[model samples]
Target: MRTPLGGNNLTAQQYESYPSADDTWTVSFNNSAGTSGTYEVYAVCLPATQAP
Candidate 1:
C-alpha cells in the first residue's frame, strides 16, 4: 500500500489449494488494504526421488 486507504475501502485476497505432504510453499502480499497495486504468491515443491 502507498497512500493507505480507509477501512471501508479495504482490499483482500484468498485461495484454496491441495499440496503434497512434501511440498514447500509460501504466500506474500495477501489480505492487505491500501492505495496500491501489487500482489504475489509463490510455491516451491520437490517430487519424491525413486530408489536407485
Candidate 2:
C-alpha cells in the first residue's frame, strides 16, 4: 500500500497454518501494518478416502 505523500504503508505479512489430528485447521496471522484491509478467504476441500 502507498500513502498520499508517496510513502510505503505496507508491512511484512506473517502467518501460519496447520491441520490437526481431529481434521481441523488452525490459521494464524499478524497485522503489523496496523491497518484494516479487505481480504478474501477460501478453501477447496475433498472427501477423505480410506486406505483399503
Candidate 3:
C-alpha cells in the first residue's frame, strides 16, 4: 500500500479464496486513518506445460 500522506497504516485484515477453475484471492485491508493511496495486487500465471 502507498499512502500519499498521514503515514502508511495498511494492514491485511482478511483473505479469502474463491472456488473456481482459476484461483483468485480476495484481500481486505484496514486503513483507520483513511489515507489516500493505491492498493495493488499481482498474480502469476503459467501455462499448464510450463507449470511444474
Choose the strongest candidate by TM-score: 2
> Cα deviation in Å at residue 7, candidate 3?
2.6
Runs in model 2 lying further than 4 Å from the true structure? 1-26
**What is the alpha-carbon lDDT for the whole of candidate 3?**
0.52
Q: What is the number of residue pairs that collide in model 1?
A: 0
Q: What value does the lDDT take at residue 13 in candidate 2? A: 54
Better of 1 and 3 by TM-score: 3
- Estimate TM-scores for all models: 0.28, 0.46, 0.37
RMSD of each: 8.0, 6.2, 4.7
Task: State the local distance difference test value for candidate 1.
Answer: 0.50
Taking all chains together, the TM-score of candidate 3 against the true structure is: 0.37
lDDT of 1 by residue, 1-52 (tens): 2223455554655555445455544343445655454444556456679999
The lDDT of each candidate is 0.50, 0.54, 0.52
Ten-residue region with minimum lDDT total, candidate 1: 1-10
Query: Candidate 3's residue-wise lDDT over 22-42, tens digit each?
Result: 676454566565655666655
Can you rank all candidates by TM-score, best first? 2, 3, 1
